[model samples]
Target: MEQNYLAPAETMQIHELLNFKTICMTSSKMMEGVVFDQELKTLFEKDVRQSITAINDLQVLLGKAPKLR
Candidate 1:
């Protein structure tokens, strides 16, 4: 069996980065409204979801971090 060494948190970070990149690409595509296809729209929607999930996770993680206050 091939072992996967990456932790779930690290995998999530990679996914977040890929999602971010996709969002950037789709945002550019969005500028040319008439040229976008269903696939692009789908990709954009998925990217938004991933980005939101990533943000929420990060917020929770940061909540555990030491604060100045």
Candidate 2:
């Protein structure tokens, strides 16, 4: 199997993306409870789902990065 590793800069970028996605997901979930418009609620739901997928993908990439000493 071929080895896959991320450079330090790439690793940092991934970490930032992961954090941003998590925040977005949390915000969407919270807004879902108070939103009165059906269309808006649906949009938030979709965002939450997409964020979850992005976060998972980011986690997998982060796991492949080399550990810092």
Best by TM-score: 2
| Candidate 2 ranges beyond 4 A from true positions | none
Worst 10 residues of 2 by lDDT: 60-69
lDDT of 2 by residue, 1-69 (tens): 998899989999999999999999999999999999999999999999999999999999999899878
What Cα-based lDDT does every candidate model obtain?
0.60, 0.96
Q: TM-scores of all models?
A: 0.50, 0.92
True lDDT of residue 33, candidate 1 = 64
Give the lowest summed-lDDT range of ten residues in model 1: 59-68
Candidate 1 wrongly placed segments (more than 4 Å):
1-35
Candidate 1 versus the native: TM-score?
0.50
Clashes of each: 0, 0
